[model samples]
Target chain A: MVAPDYLQVLVLAAVAIALIIVTIEVVARIVRPHAPNPNKYETYECGERTIGSTGVKIGVQYYLYALVFIIFDVEAVMLFPWAVSFKEFDGVLGLGTIIFAEVFMFVGILLIGLVYAWKRGVLEWQEM
Target chain B: MVDLMNWAGIYDTIEGFLSGLGLSFIIPLTLYAIAALILFGFVAALVLVTTYLERKILSDIQVRLGPMETGGRRFHGILQPVADGIKLLQKEDIMPKNRDKLPYYLAPLVVFVPVFVIMGLIPLGFIPLDIASLNKNLLVAADLDIGILAILALAVIPTLGAVMAGWSSRNKFTTLAMLRSVAQGISYEIPFVLAALAVVLAAGSMNLSEIVKAQSGLWFIFLMPIGFIVFFMAALAEIHRIPFDVDEAENELVSGVIVEYSGMRFAFFYLAAYAELFIAAALITILFLGGWAGPVLPGVMWFFIKCFVIIYVIIWMRGTLPRVRIDQMLAVGWKVMLPLALLNLLITSSILML
Candidate 1:
């Protein structure tokens, strides 16, 4: 119940260090051909050879999808669990239900925003 | 737990160390082993069944008959996993030519281990088991103080494996898919973590049980609507399913990071994908649904029902919604979500402080 005691932290840190060493060792062993092909090292994040200049940048439509993702993602995680617990804590006190209802209202507002975005074509797929 | 750890001598060394570790540790370790084995066998079966059900349900939504080809007896497709196991067993495993054999071989294990560990953090169902005539808490393996952190920390590995798998394959499609996966993972993870942070703030403990307990009066979702929305979306993205699955976009990336994998190696990725889905789903249940908190049914049933329902939603959407563009996906993470998450955290903190 207390924050993992010092010993636990030390053990965890040790595990982390071991994992790092293991990673380095694995990488060293795996990179076989000693020839430094200047192109090979630049893969993905390491900026390897141009992988067709990545994907073309789309406009606000991309932003909108991510926004909606955030919106719906939060909705699913929070509300479903709340629904389960609300049924449990229910017993004459209308307070929890009222709070839950208020959340539904918030979701209602977001839906309105979504509809607005939909109408404004914010979520529409556009050619970049 | 210390006693449990003393019992945790490496399995390879078990035979030699058996008499040396003393019977005191042996007795408890034996009990722990039995309990763990039972738990594993049960969950493994559940994973298989849950997978079959997801496939069946998703197929039904798409108006396709699923697993009918396998059963040969009027949708008796429950035997599918058995058939799959046999086929995987019979097939020869192949390593990609340019792959790192060690981590490449380790990818599946890395993918699964995180999932197995996170199971402990979730308050699915606990059984009371006797060890050395002691009533030990048999529900979970080890319930850490930072329970949610334990889950999140372990959850990050599968994406790395996908990246490693892609890189090792030396395939263009996989590398592209993995790049998208990395972006998806990092983006979704930020919101998920922030959302968890919000819940932890409200609950005042990382222990999932304690968080569930905090909601005895009210669930955090009611107080923090934005938080719930952000969290669930992030969870969906984390699993790389349906709407957020541009990483594996079949038409675009052509099987993406897993294009080159086949046979049992592919099965490992498939199993890992489903496992990741449940692990994330279970976390959502624990964090927001009130871990094991429900009326009429026992906590585990309610927990599972809620989980299947969410999983069903993912399956449903897969057949319903068209995949979103990748950059748009990132935009959602940064432009909209990051801001909303910050606001939700701010509001929740202010409320708790007051």
Candidate 2:
């Protein structure tokens, strides 16, 4: 019963996806027009001749948003197992109140972080 | 009243038939191979049809006719996607000079494979089909115990491809798009997972088919309307549709991460996007709309109908709403959707306890 059926399905589907992608690409290579001039191969930037470097300084706002997201994302992941396992304590007296209070306390701490971010205006897109 | 597609029974029969033909050793391999092909074909065909439908629906919503020239005036250019696909296949495959070749090439496949794989796990509900004399129809390819988690895990992977595409393109526009995608992916995923966790909590199982079964009496939408709404909004973000399409703002980014890709490589990204659209709707259907649950139609038909209805809603959103800024997108994901999902979960837990 513990067989890796899901893994097998995944592998099989991966192979199929690969096969389809390859077949389409290879056929396109054979039959499609192949005309690659220097201009055609140039990175598309509104058809203007390339200028400036690709790696430029990005706004710190994006980074800040990502930081807040990562924090919340981790918290969400932890919450899932706890939520699922709530059934294990289904019959215990005061299970509902105990679990609710504990989970909310965990959420409340994260909410504090969120509130800090909000107050700092890091949640604003144009903050940078 | 319970009609099922009976894919499991059909697989057993096929295995038996293969054994009778004295090819028992290859049965497992053959069965999986066929299933894979079926799933691939299903996704490809559905994507093609939906692309056309989106065009036509959008045109109709805007009071115009769409694609009346393709497919010889019959079916309103239903074959336009096929024609467009052939045209794309025949177009020049351009590789931007001075770009990172390996990641550039691998990005589309990375984005596409997982999305394609997800289709096999979506249960279309049981239909009472008399095709192979099989009962107990399980419409999905595999009903893994961790179906919801498997989907959540795989859906998280496509952002890697977008980032790869952006970085490999060696362009500032793609880089900006990649940044937006990463932020969008991270921010939206939390709410998406939380909303889904609410459903999982209510259903008491992560298996999607079981979730559907739990909904037979009352769909989760009725019980957890806020979660359903959050799920829908986060889903739109996951697929990078309008209002959440900051990653690929056409007016600003040209084409975003796929800006440098051409030909079939470009088509892979296009295909994956449509596949994501379908899967998002299918997930909603299964989780909230009660997969294939309706009064009159067959389960499979009901499933697709519900999916298309959601698809229509999404298309309507694309047609109507202006794109939100990146920060605004994150704000909604973090500030609005996430907390609502948590509250919905807490409410659901309290209700279940009572």
Highest-lDDT candidate = 2
Candidate 2 Cα errors over 4 Å, as ranges:
A1-4, A91-94, B1-26, B129-136
Residue pairs whose backbone atoms clash in candidate 2: B3-B127, B4-B127, B5-B137, B6-B137
Q: TM-score of each model's B chain?
A: 0.87, 0.93
Candidate 1, residues B213-250, lDDT tens digits: the string is 88878877787989999998988898898799999998
> What's the distance in Å from true for residue B209, model 1?
0.5
Candidate achieving the largest DockQ: 2
TM-score against truth, every candidate: 0.69, 0.92
Candidate 1 chain B worst ten-residue window by lDDT? B127-136
What is model 2's DockQ versus the real complex?
Answer: 0.59
For TM-score, the strongest prediction is: 2
**Model 1, B207: alpha-carbon shift in Å?**
0.2
Q: Each model's DockQ?
A: 0.05, 0.59
Q: Each model's fnat?
A: 0.00, 0.58
Please report how far candidate 2 places residue B62 from its true position, in Å. Answer: 1.4
Q: What is the lDDT of candidate 2?
A: 0.83
